[model samples]
Target: MRILVLANFGMGLYNFRKELLKELIKNNHEVFISLPKDEYKPKLEEIGCEFIDTPVSRRGTNPITDFKLFMNYKKIIKEIKPDIVLTYTIKPNVYGGLACRVTKTPCIVNITGLGTAVENGGVLQRITLYLYRISLKKVNCVFFQNEENKKTLIKSKAIVGKNMVLPGSGVNLEHYNLMEYPKPQVVNFLFISRIMKEKGIDQYLEAASYLKQKYSNVNFHIVGFCESEYKNKLTNMQDKGVIEYHGKQSDVKRFYEISHCTVHPSYYPEGMSNVLLESAACGRPIITTNRSGCGEVVDEGVNGYKVKPENSNDLIEKMEKFLNLSYETKVKMGLSGRRKVEIQFNRRTVIDTYLAEIHNITER
Candidate 1:
């Protein structure tokens, strides 16, 4: 079977889906990737996969450009004649699915998250949702990362009732294995995400500031790139000594190993948070917002805590819980998190499910 995976960015697919790609190759399936040209090109080739460069505008919505993208994608699909196409993210899922439909090729769309456009809701949101409803009608299957997204799709009639709900791209347990629970020397809290205001960065900073004033022993560490728009806010927070920003990191496991807990206060409608899953896989407790995708991962008092999104008081309270817990209690919470991932978010399970779905769609 020949499969084409379409996405906006190269690194995300290359890194997160490597295991799945390897499995497909091992099974004698031909897998091709379609993404923007990036540093991962050599790596993708080395993995025995063919790469196709496609230009994509990830941040904006322009009808003329989007039409051109759709036409380009249509041409590519016609030329490749892939048995099936798998797409992720908003632009690919909408425009790519339409292109596949034009070529009469079966396509599966994985809604990774309801991006700012749809979540924010207005004229753009209405238009995008209408496009989704139209495009999805032709898709073989739609995969959602969390229940909230699935519910929203169903409510909006964008997808049918039988669509699959997958837990976010499963965490790589091998790479994020349970580390020996670290003793909290300073009650270090880590937030790993793109430093966007939508990700509740301000809330995190506010919580960090409030905590630091009360408990001098507490420390906040942030890991990820700051978009230009939000750079000033991040800079302001850092200047105020609210948090230590460790710019984009290729290796996040080290930070997870040293930190006592992970905090993701994002109000953005997420799919499933890979950071939270990775933290849990590393045997570290998590404190995240009680919003859609974020809320689905935690078991409250058992493995982690869920605080209200954008509520600095709630976030600070949860952080204080971790700070106040006995070393033994913290260790137990971390163990519980590891157990949760083992039973639910294992990468193998996600890969297997995806493969089975692909086979089912292609066979039909």
Candidate 2:
């Protein structure tokens, strides 16, 4: 079958969904990927997939630009004549999906995350929901990353068609196999996510500040590019010894190797957090928010601890709680997380599920 994939960027596809794409090619299917021309495009091409440069202004909601995107998708679909279509993120799901509908092509959409606009509740949320409702009407299937997202769309009547939930682009266990838990002498915590307000960077920074002053052996590390006005603040914090900032790393396994625990304080509407999944797969204990996307990974004191959303005090308290655990217990906690990911979030499971759905769709 000829398969076409639409997405906003290449980083996520190259990182998370490469396994699925590889499997499709191994099955002798011709695959074409459509997204903005980014660094990972060549990598995707190297993996035997054709790349189509589809300009997408990811964060903006300009009507003229969106209409152009819709038209572009329509043009691509009409020319390629793909047997099936797959789309990720918002613009691809909405606009790509609409194009597929008009062309009478089968399309599958993955709701990676709802973003703050939908979850925060506002005019934008209403507009986004309306777009989803119309675009997904005739699509073959809808895959949500989490149950909360599924419930929200269903309750809002945005998804009245066939849909199901998936473990947000499940982690690759082979790539991120269990690693030895770092020694407890200097307990290091990692905060990996885009430096945005919605991602709870402020809460993480606050916790880092208080904990660093209170404890001498602990180190707080920040990773990922700053999508907000946090460059100067991160620089200041790093210079002052409050946190160690490593801006945007393509390879994070080395950082995970030195870390004892991973911290994610995000309050954002995430489909699922790849950072937590990857960290857990690497046998690292996690300290994250007590929310859906994050809460699902942790087993509440079994694998890791969860703090109240946006509460710096609670975050500090949890870090202290983790700090007080015996070294042996920390190792056991990390192992527990590894076991969870292996059983529940393995990347193979996601790939097989997609293949099964695609097979069923085509056979019908």
Candidate 3:
């Protein structure tokens, strides 16, 4: 089968869907990936997948630009005549699905997250939901990273009836296998996410400040690219010694190895958070918001803690729990996290699920 995979960014497809792509190739499927051109093009090509540049804005909604994107995707779909189309993220899932519909090609859309527009709830949110409902009508299957998103789609009538749900992009257990819970001289807490205010960076900074006042032995690390809209806020957080911002890291495993705990206080709606899964796979406990995708990963006291979204006090309390845990208990929590991923969020399970769905759709 010839498969076309569409995502917003090249790096997103390269990093998140590599296992699925490899599995398809192993099964003698020809794969073509469409994404915004990025430095990761070489890496995508190296994986034996053809890459096509599709310009897209990661943030905000513009109908004019989106229509152009839709037309561009429609042209690509007509030209490729792929046996099946699989899409991820917001724009691709919406516009790509629509384009595939025009070509009478089967589409499998993965709703990674609802994004800020939906979470914020306004005219844009309503319009996006309307578009989603229309686009999804022709999709053969819809995969969701979290139950909340799946439920939301169903409630909004965007998707209904037994939709597939997978845990994030399923972390590669072999690649992010359990590491010894590092015993650094100073305890380090790392927040790995795009520098977005909606991700609760402000709350994280506040918690870090609160923690630092009492616990001088702790260090806060922030990893990810700073978006221009949120750059000034990130800068202010850095100036306050709230976080040691390590912008856009290719080697996140290194940070995971050294960090004591992974924190993602995202108040914005998320699909399943990849960082939480990777951290858990790396045998690190997480501190994230008590919201849909973020809360689902942690089993409360078992592996990690969940705090109220955008509430620094709640985050501070959770951080204190980690700080207060006995060394043995901390190790045990990390091990529990690894076990959870092995059973529920393994990469093989995700890849197999995707392949099975794709085959089912094409066979029909």
Q: How many backbone clashes does candidate 1 have?
A: 0
Error of 1 at 338 (Å): 0.6
**After best superposition, candidate 1 residue 351: deviation in angstroms?**
1.0
Model 2, residue 34: distance off in Å is: 0.5
Model 3, range 209-236, lDDT digits (tens) per residue? 8888898889899999887987787678
The per-candidate count of clashes, in order, stands at 0, 0, 1
TM-score, cand. 2 vs. native: 0.99
lDDT of each: 0.87, 0.93, 0.87
TM-scores for candidates 1 onward, in order = 0.96, 0.99, 0.95
By lDDT, who's the top model here?
2
Give the top-scoring candidate (TM-score): 2
User: What are the runs in model 2 whose C-alpha is more than 4 Å off?
Assistant: none
Task: Give the range of the ten consecutive residues with the poorest summed lDDT in model 3.
Answer: 159-168
How much is 166 displaced in model 3, in angstroms?
Answer: 1.1
Candidate 2 residue lDDT tens string, 1-364: 9999999999999999999999999999999999999999989999999999999999998999999999999999999999999999999999999999999999999999988779878899899999988998889999999999899888888787789888889999989989987767899999999899988999999989998998999999988999758999999999999999999999999999999999999999888999999999999999998788888999999889999998999999999999999999999999999999999998898899899999999889
- List the candidate 1 regions with Cα displacement exceeding 4 Å: 236-241
Q: Tens-digit lDDT track for model 1 on 1-364?
A: 8888889997788767889888888889888888889988888878878999989999878889899889988988888889999899999999998898788899889999988888889998899889988878888889889988888888889886348888789889899988998766788899999988878888888888888899988889999988898777777878988788889987788999789999999998888889998999999989998888788779999888999888888888888887998988889999999999889888898899888888887776
Better of 2 and 3 by TM-score: 2
